[model samples]
Structures are given as structure tokens and as C-alpha cells.
Target: MTSAQKPLHSAFGPQTTAQEALAGRDLRGKVAIVTGGHGGIGLETTRVLSNAGATVIVGARDINKAQDKLSTMKNVEVIHLDLADPKSIDQFAADILKSNRALDILINNAGVANPPVIKDARGFDTHFATNHLGHFQLTARLWEALIKSGNSRVITLSSISHMLGPIDLSDLNFTKRPYDKDISYGESKTACSLFAVELDKRGKEHGIRAFAVNPGAILTGLTRHLTDEELAAWGVRRGENSEFISPEGFKSAEQGAATSIWCAVSPLLEGKGGVYCENCDIAAIVPADSKLMTGVREWAIDQTAAEMLWTVSEDLLHIGSIPGLSK
Candidate 1:
């Protein structure tokens, strides 16, 4: 069910690496796509899935860089995808659809954070447009391909920072209200969580299940724009020389990728969808006023908010009600 947000006490924890998450699984014959797959947590996810014999399609804004980085990997394809551009999204999805292959997994793992206010071609907030709307459109466009697989999993990365969200659909692009970077980023992540909620609700009957993942505090490219001081302030600490940490410390990129990989492949989650997962397990729900950076906030998992966000997203994209995305 979409609202089963309780933890299953999986053996895995915050310290699990992407490789560890898929330790005994064989993904041969499976196909997966990872946005920003050439770098950081996404890279780890792509590597593990490909190593397990799954074909990995990596969506990167910088095609050359992505190709170069992934050139040596087996069964990996790099495609140009500028999330802030609707045209690029259409082309990406069209390209995939043209293949006539069922897409088994889709990790909407690419996103922008902490940048100066920037807008897309349609004057939408770059954070909201690229992070939320772009992935939303891409998923919608690829709905047919996903449903082709008898059972498909869609993993969208949310954040603990979503505690600040319940996005103001009224001012999504900051057209009416003042724009604050953290708030805007939070809103985008919040939007991502809600998207999973509604998408799982609508797609489950079709053998497609969606989940939102909170990948813990990993220092990845998403935080590149942040300074050391900002990192400290945000509580995303990292050791100078470690890519794995004890459960008590911050996450490494590999560790951060675990929950996403788990969401995509773990059999334990086969019958579950729409829950917010963290530390490679379904997280508990917390009150709106909570301060701890664990568990999902009530607003982020509210069914009403999810439904409203879906409609607002469809309206903003001007895509209207479509087959897989309609409420």
C-alpha cells in the first residue's frame, strides 16, 4: 500500500554501500537508468547495477564528461539530458521509448542544489524545474516503457531537508513570494516525495511501484556549490580521506547510494511503494515541528499534498492529464 511507511528492520543500515545493498542479487536481463550516473552516489549506483549485469543508461547534462567517465564500464550508455529543458527531456524519453525495451528501474537521482537563483527557459525556478518538474516529465514520458516491464521500480531521491516542504503550489517558481535558496531546494525535494506518493498510488495496479528515498547525509556533487562552512552548518560532515564511515558519522557517496539501490532491487520491498525510505529502510513519520534530520515529515507524506502537487505539476508543465500521470 502507498501509506505503509513503517520500517521493516532490514539488516542493512546507514553504513551499507551500494555494492553491499545488491550483494546477492543478479540483475542480468534487467535494465536501469540513473540520472547523473557518472558522478557521486549515482555513479556508485550505476557501477553496482552494471556490475551485476544490468544495462545502465546514464543521463548526464555534460554528455562528453559522462561518456568519458563511463567509457570503460561495461553495458553502460551515456545520453545527454538537460533536466531544465523540456525539449531535452522529450528527446531523452523518446530515445528510450524508441528502443522498444521494458525499462526495469529509473533512479531520478540528478538534481541541482544551493545555486544562485536561476530560471529555466519557461522562467521556472531552476531548482524546482530541473529537480522536480524535469524528472516528473521524464517519468511521465517514459510511463509506457516502464509499464512494459511486469514489475518496475521508480526511485526518486528526496532529502531530510524536505522537512521544510509542503511546497507552496501557489508560488512554485517564486513568482509571487520571496525566493530563499534552502526553502526552494526544500520545496523541490518535497515535491519529489509527493510525486512518488501519487505515482505509486496510480502505478501500482500496472505493476509499477515508486518510492522516495532519503539517502542520508552524503557529501556528493549536489553539495559542490556549498562551502566548508556551509557544509558544517548543514550537518553534512565528511572525513578527509574516507568514502565509508561508521553509522555515527556522515555518509560516503557509496553509502549514500545504498538506499537508492535497495529501493530498486531489494525483494523485501517488492510489495511496498510510496513510502519514504532512509538508511536503506522505510522511515518513520514525524510531526511537522520535528527538528531531527531523520524520518519523513508529515507534510511530505500527506496524501492530499501529493495529489495536489501532481495536478499542479501537470498544470505547470502544460502537459495536462495523461494516461499514467492522471489522478
Candidate 2:
């Protein structure tokens, strides 16, 4: 079916480039903070925002890489931020707060793929810690700046992988369940979507809107964990010799970054919040029995689930409240 005929919300497709999405849009005075801005869709996001005249801060774990990549861009600042490290998050927040600049946009895009079971220095699962909790803490720490910047937007990068699993709050670390890292990654992405829902529900009164984006299959560092054979088995084609895929599947990194740019600056989404988006548009709700590979899942967008996960996440991080974030 054509996108207009589809029941679920339609977007520009996985092949739409960032420039195409932001065509004719102007965001000269805006400031955007993007994690993983040195590579993948994150890098494209940074480039697009900067080109549109926004002051883009490139958050990277690797200082040298961030500096090198952002050096050529005007009004771009590269800051060291390792989402997996709480201390690093705190430092990044503190530095930004000291500078006293309001944060206009935050794209929680840094993530890890399926890796062997490993924990951070604090013994949290690598996927949950990096993909969800780390961004959670970072957002919380930057809550003040986000609030201070009127009309601020926070976008979390979720994925279709969320449909593969649900959050396992009972044993969030996978200590009781089998140590399947892929499942853990899926669960973490689910948490990312839910978190955005809760954030928007609570923070909208302050002009801070929250959203989650599913950047359809893009060849980026996030997929580095999968080998060539695994990628082929997963129905992903890389080389020129690959089989022809339908229009519904896969995209380049620039195309993957499109929705984020749209959400960040589009007048079309004014006053909207708490929705999962893909392909430069708000995602349509998924039907319970539908087999469509697009749109947000019910469980991932559940209100109760989102609130429950928020509480659980705070408990695990040992923080009673998100720094400057309050209902």
C-alpha cells in the first residue's frame, strides 16, 4: 500500500535524506545536543542542524574523534560524554550548566548493539546501562538546561527491535534469565521509547516536549557487532551482489537521520509530544493483530509501563529525582 493509504502514520521512508527532510526549514538560533554525533546517523544529525544555522554540540565518548569531526563545522562544540559512565555524565552536565546555555534539543542516539554479556564498572547490564539508563541519567542531569530553553525538544532513538522483546523489570540485569545479549538490546530499546513517553507526559507543561524515533535499518556503527554472515542471515544486504529488497526495508545513514531532523525543527509537529516516530513523521499506532513491520508497539507505548520503568530506572540509578526534571 502507498504511505497515504496505510493506517499507521506514514513517514518519508528509509531512503529520505536529512537535507530532504529539512528542506526550506530554518533554525538559526536553536541549539541541539546530539549524542554519538561523531558517527552514523548522529553525525548526519549534527551536520544537518549545523548547516541549518543551529549551534550543535557533538557529544562523544572519544574526545579526539569528536574534536576532529566537529572542527570543520561552525557553531559546533565537541564535548566528552560517555553515557555508560555516570561520573562522565555528571561532568558533562556540570560543564554545560556552568556555561549557562539553554539546551534547545537533545537527541539521545548513542547505543550499543548485541555484545557478549558484559557490565559497566557498576555491574549494570551493558545494553540497559548504555542504551537506557545512561541516557536517562544524562537527560536528568540536563533537565534544568532543557527546561530553561523554552520550546525545547528531547528525542530518544528507539528501534523496530523493540517488537522483538519487552522490558524485563523483574530481572533487569538478566541475572535470572538466559544471558542472551540480543534480547537484552531489544529490551533496552523498548525502555528508551517508554522513557520518552513518560518524559513528555510530565514535562510538557514546561514547554519541553519528548519523543522517540525509530531510524529504520541503517548501516552504522551500531550494527558493528553483527558479522557479515549474521547480517546476511538477518536479511540485510550490503554489497552490490545482494538481492533486491522491497521499498519497505532498509536505508542509508543519511536517510536514517531524516526523522530526527524533522522532529527537531518541523512546524508540522508543533505542540505534539510523547509519540514514537519514524521516517520523518509521527508513527501510527500498531494494531494488536497487525503484521505490519512499521509503527510503535502497544507495550512500548503503554503509559503504565512507561511510568513503572521510570520509577524502576530511578531506583537502579540510586537517584530519587532527575536533577532538574519534575512533574
Candidate 3:
């Protein structure tokens, strides 16, 4: 279904923390898979979910680091997954399915930002491959498990940057146009938002719902590739005597994860799907001139674009229609 892009007047806002979002909820017995759950907001997402008694499986590129960081957490496990590699994506999905666990929540949270222009072994743009295509393939492979859960949610982490660029379907890999880091990142995020739109449409009848979230700008390792000058340009800073800091209005890692956890378990969103959310509420759709950093862009939630992306993704991944989903 298409997104109306209307606000839900949620009780939570930008200041809400992950712990706060899950305060009254109990996830005891639920099974969740969080991609890139070893660091930043992903780690916080893992912590809070597991704290709430869910069995969280973290998909990490560095299993040792994930294991080390999660050592103190009970009911959490880490598995190897490199979203940039298709083989790795497939294997991770296979292994998870082999566990005979019904997947209750799938958070597509791991992503790269503004890396040097490069392509995967399959020649797809690195940002697109890791941020969107990988999750698409993973979700497709895990369709059965998600269906088995009876009521499941797939949360795809998008960004406000999705407003900055349009998807260049003709040359999605940047084979012809000069590569622009921000634009490439924007396109990938837009793809993520649209993926949620189409995924919800196709899976809703089977009791699966998907949402795309714009976790407000948080100081995370996702910004590791940005240089000092770039950070300065964005008004962020780091002190020789202190820790890295973000500009005013940026959320803390826990705060950044708030919306993700909200979308994953909020009863308010029970019957809704395909909308873009932020600050723990459904975001409004705004025009290009409204705001540079807030609200959902029309293209990001367009039904037509979502459908096109689903077809293109299927062709790119060489998959036919989803098992129980019709074309």
C-alpha cells in the first residue's frame, strides 16, 4: 500500500530514548534480528531489545567485536554478515533459517555513508549494495521465517538525506554520471524507504509489516569516513581533550534508536505499514523547499517508485516473485 505520510501525533518525539520507547512493553519470547547491531545506535537497539527479554541475534561484519561488546548482554547472539557481499548475505540468511526460529523483528540498521566511490564484486554501487540491496536480499530469503512469526515487523533505517537526491534508475551504479558521495548515499537511502513501501504492500496480507525510519542525525561510526573538515562543515566537532560531539539538534545514539524500536513494537502502528517515520511518529510529507533535514520527501514514499524499485531489485538479485507473494 502507499503511504499517506500523515503524522500519528505520537507521544514520543526527538528526545525520546530507546529505553523510553520500550518502557511499558514486554518482548519476552520474541525473536529479533538486527543488522549491524554491534555498534552505535544498532548496539543500543540490541541492548534495549534484549533487556526487554527478546532473543536478539546481531548480524555483524566483525563477529569478534560484536561478541566482545555483547558479552554482558543475555539472550543476544552475534553472527557474521557483510552486507556488501551477496554470498555473505545469503549465508547469513541460510544460517538464521537453519535455527528454526520464527523471526519477529528484522531491523535493517547497518549502513555506510559517504565512502569513496567503489563497487561490489557484482559491480553495484557500494552504498546501494550494502545499505539497500543486501537487506532486500536478506528479507527475501527470510520471508518464510518472518511469515512463521504470525505478526512480524521489518524496520529499514532510512535517513533525511533521502531528500537530497533522486534515484537514477538508468544508471543506478553510477557507471555514467560522475560519482557524488552525498547523492549516492541519498539514492541508497531513498531505495531503503521505497523498499519498505513495496515490502509492506506485498507482505501485509501474510501479517508482515515494514516501515522506513529516519533516525535523526546521531554521532555514530557511520560517519567514520567523514574528514575533520567535513564534520566542521556540518557544524560537528571533536576536542583533543574530549569526545566527539555533534551539533545542536542531533540525537544521542539511544535517542537515534528510539524510532527504530518504536516502529518495531508500537501498538499504534499495528495496522499501518509503508509510511516513513521519525522521532517515534509518522512523519509528514513536505515539499522540496519546506525543510532540508526534516519530513519525508515525496519520492521517498511514492508508490510508483516503490513498485519500480521492487522489480529492479528482483532483477538485480536474480530472484523470482516471493514464494507466497504474487507478482
Q: Which candidate's TM-score is highest?
A: 3
Candidate No. with top lDDT = 3
The alpha-carbon deviation from the true structure for residue 235 of candidate 1, after best TM-score superposition, in angstroms, is 5.7
Candidate 1 per-residue C-alpha lDDT over 1-327 given as tens digits, one digit per residue, 9 for 90 to 100:
245989999999988998998977999999999999999889889999999999999999999999888988999998889888889999999999999999999999999998765677688998899889999999999999899997999999999989986789888889888878889999999999999999999999989999999988877777767766777675545577733223456788899999999999999998889999998899998888888889998888889999988888888888856676585
Candidate 1 vs. true structure, TM-score:
0.94
What is the lDDT of every predicted structure here?
0.89, 0.83, 0.91
Q: Write the per-residue lDDT of candidate 2 for residues 1-327, one digit (tens) a residue.
A: 112212234346667899988886787888889999989899999999999899988779999988887788888898899988889998988988998989999999899998654777788899999999999999898888998998899999999888876788898887897877778888899999999888988888888988889998777777767766777775765657643332346687789999998888777777787888888887777765566768777878888889999989888888655544653
Sort the predicted structures by lDDT, highest score first.
Answer: 3, 1, 2
- Summed backbone clashes in each candidate are 0, 1, 0
Q: For residues 181-240, could you state the per-residue lDDT of candidate 3 as single tens digits?
A: 889999999999999999999999999999999999898998878888989988988888
Please give the ranking of all candidate structures by TM-score, highest first, separated by commas. 3, 1, 2
lDDT-best of 2 and 3: 3
Query: For every model shown, what is its TM-score relative to the native structure?
Result: 0.94, 0.91, 0.97
Clash pairs, model 3 backbone: none
